[model samples]
Target chain A: MFLITNEPLSVTEVEAVVADPGAGALVTFTGVVRDNNLGKSVHYLEYEGHPPMAEKAMAQIGDEVTARWPGARVAMAHRLGRLDIGEASVIISVSTPHRADAFAACQYAIDRLKEIVPVWKKEVWEGGEYWIEGSTAAS
Target chain B: MITVQVQLFAAYREAVGARQVPFDVPQGATVLDVWQQLQATYPKLRTPRPVAAINDAYATLDTVVQPGDLIAYLPPVSGGRSLIPSPSGEG
Candidate 1:
């Protein structure tokens, strides 16, 4: 259930999508907006994404996870538009037959999402704003 | 000549001040060719070549573009939890 939406994200909703009867462990990771960054007081964050491509990238991440950890299920959702401080910007859920696989796969999903997803965040500070671009070089 | 739809996102979009633009290029023109043309038109696009995609799929800069294709120039992504600091030192 890879998604890019303007609606607020929910961990439970994402978790439900990856629920598996045979799974022994489920791991959910929620990314929330922070109030401060780089020593500046952040007012809010505006996220923009190429929806189709973002979802494709997420699905690709899921494929990678399943290949590495067979029988693992992954689900992810990313929120777009204005997000206030403490609001969840992204959620990832992974279910695996073992706890270690669930934790590792969940982490991999978020890390890969950051690398390949076509979503950008604009940080609005007290008096100014700037688009934040990740450091990873585009391959 | 082939015409392709060029899409920009994030800083690239802000730099161009538009989300989409149309470009006409000779047949066999690659993504790099379109990027050069884009930079020429919008000098503010001073950032280096970014991740490129065609018709919603990731493609190399050397990939040849097709007419009416959607070519996206994606700036460095900032989604999910980022452990690395941004180029501007503000992640």
Candidate 2:
């Protein structure tokens, strides 16, 4: 399962989507909004995404994970709109036959999501705001 | 001449002050050509080489754009967890 929503992200919901009886290990990663960036106090974050393209990119990441780690199931979700400090903005869950594969695949999923997914976040600071540039435009 | 719609996001959207832009260009114009035209029209578009997307897919500057194409000018992504530093040694 891959999605982009304006609702709050839930790790349990993401984990359930990737749960498999055959899998002995499960790993999940959640991205939370931080209060400060580069020594500047942040009020909140606003995320925007191209839903169709972002979903396609996320599904491709899941496919890549399954190809690399056999028997692995992956699910991911990214939140849109304004998110306050400590709010969960993104969640990824992976289940595999072993813990090693689960850990690696989960990490890879988030990394690939950031690299290819068409999601952008704007950091609203005390006085001003700027869009955070994570990866290069071509990445 | 061909007419294409340009979708702007993030800073690009803010710069243009509109979500979509329409351009009429020569039939053989490429994606880069549309970008050049945009720069000439909107001087506030400071990013000389913004990312381009055709029909919701990532596209190159040299990609040929067809009539009625939905071209998106995307800004850089900044929402990944990698930007955050970990308290422990492991990131």
Candidate 3:
């Protein structure tokens, strides 16, 4: 499933979907907004998604993941609009017959999304704000 | 002839004075190529645009660009721990 929401994400819901007895492994990744950056204190964060296109892009990514690992269960959810600190920004869960594939696919989802998803985020620091888009430097 | 459509988000949108921009890309233009040309014209547009997408996902230069293509130029996003109200929404 592909979705963009302004509401907070529920990890329990995500876990429930990927929970399958046939699956030997399950992985979940949550992206959250954090306070303080560089030298600035972030008051909040804003995310915007080109919904229609984002969904299409996500589907393509899903297709790629499946092709890479057969029988992999993949799901992704991304947050939109302004968010408070510590809120979930993105959630990805992957389940597979083996733990290895589940781990690999879960990571792949997060990595690919950073590169291709048409989502933009802006940071509002205490007293100031700036819009920055791109993947986390390390990821 | 392939017409390319470009959309600016956040600061780029405000900087360019609008949210959506469409242009006819000369046949066989890559997303990166369009980015270079647009940057050349909109001098204020800065570098290290943390991310980019064609049709809403991370796109590559090898991705063939055609007329009516849509590209998004995004400034590097600031990742903080919280969500706030959109400043633009403020009256």
Report per-candidate TM-score of chain A alone.
0.96, 0.95, 0.91
Classified by CAPRI criteria, candidate 3 counts as incorrect
lDDT of 1 at B3: 96
Could you give the candidate ranking by DockQ, starting with the highest?
1, 2, 3
Using TM-score as the measure, which candidate wins?
2
What DockQ does model 2 achieve? 0.31
What does candidate 1's lDDT look like per residue over B1-91, in tens digits? 9999999998899889999988898999999999998898899898666678899877888999999999998887764343222333211
- Give the number of the best model, judged by DockQ: 1
Give candidate 1's TM-score: 0.88
Better of 1 and 3 by DockQ: 1
Model 1 residue pairs with clashes: none
* Residues A106-139, model 2: lDDT tens digits: 9988877786788898889878998878542222
Question: Where is model 1 more than 4 Å wrong at Cα?
Answer: A136-139, B79-91
The digit string of per-residue lDDT tens for model 2 on B4-78 reads: 999988788888888897889889888888988988888898877777889988788889999999999877666
Using lDDT as the measure, name the better of candidate 2 and candidate 3.
2
User: Which digits, one per residue and each the tens of the lDDT, describe model 3 over residues A35-109?
Assistant: 866667789988886777667656667777888889887778888998999899999888899988988888777
